[model samples]
Target: MNPKVTDYISSNIKWQKELEIIRNVLLELPLEEDIKWGIPAYIYKKKNIMGLSAFKNYCGLWFHHGCFLKDEINILINAQKDKTKGMRQMRFISVDEIDTDIVKQYVLEAMANSEAGLEVKPKKNTNPVVIPEELNIQFSKNEKLKYKFNEFTLSKQREFCEYILSAKREATKQSRIEKIIPMILNKIGLNDKYRNC
Candidate 1:
């Protein structure tokens, strides 16, 4: 067992027992236990099989490639159905809801699926760059900003686009664009502040 995972479970005030029950069940499988995303992630053949976590309302397991699992029993739930394609979760509000034998069956099935090479293809970001109208106008008028924005990677450009477009109000969007123009001129990514030193 990962000591971090053990500590995480024991430290949970609301779902400690529920988390421990799921952890104990997962530990019995062939999957290697490791800590990932600050939770217990089980792996087989170095591929993520499942991860255990405690949410505010529920404790559950996220099956990494769960889209490929045959849900004849229909135990899986698409937590983000529209956005999440490859992953699925099984949530439990109480420890009694965790049927250990059934969970073992699902775990074994996930292992088999992994062994069979079933997988979800990664989603491609295929849409063209979504430059806001204000930013586009600015880009056309300011040659330096235009040159710097064009010099940025596709991801960096998309990051700026998403940041500006995520604003709900037109004024907010304009304000965001104005705020980022200097950063663009400095050739900085929108997430530069959060990047590691």
Candidate 2:
């Protein structure tokens, strides 16, 4: 059990009771509980099986590989439509909506699927990394940074490239480039901080 998850559930004034009701069912599963993405997540074999979260309007469960579930109850919905590939959400508005027995059944099935090596592997990002003009200008100024950047895996290089391009204004792009120079030189990936959790 992670102390952070206690703070998470306790902090949600709107859905604390409802979340706790569902959490009781999740607790019965043979999974390790910890916090990931700053939310309560249950792990099986080091893979995230599900997570608990709260919003202003609702509290919900996030199934990490929910696409594989039979979902005969029709409770699962893709939270992000086309943008989200495999994750599905089962949202609840109140304590009355929870059915612990069904929840347990779903979790047991998900665990079985996970143990069977079922997964929705994301398509490979084959598109070439596009270096923004601002980044190119910076690279021209600091040749060593450019040299070091190429040493990284394509995914890492693309992360840095997109980081600069994602900023709307020129100043923001320049600042983002400046911010990442040290990281690039040190061979650090941009999202490294969140990756472990």
Task: Indicate which candidate wins on lDDT.
Answer: 2
Across residues 1-197, which tens digit of lDDT does each residue of candidate 1 receive? 77877888888879998888877888877778877766778999899899888888988989988888887889899989888888999889997899988788888888999999998877668789988898999988998999999999888899999999899999999899989999999988898765521
TM-scores, all candidates, are 0.75, 0.88
Q: Candidate 1 local accuracy as lDDT? A: 0.86
Q: What is the lDDT of residue 16 in candidate 1?
A: 92
TM-score, cand. 1: 0.75
Per residue, candidate 2 scores C-alpha lDDT tens digits across 118-197 of 98888989999999888788789989989998998999999999989889998998899889989999988898877656
Clash totals for all candidate models: 0, 0
> Distance from true position, residue 68, model 2, in Å?
1.2
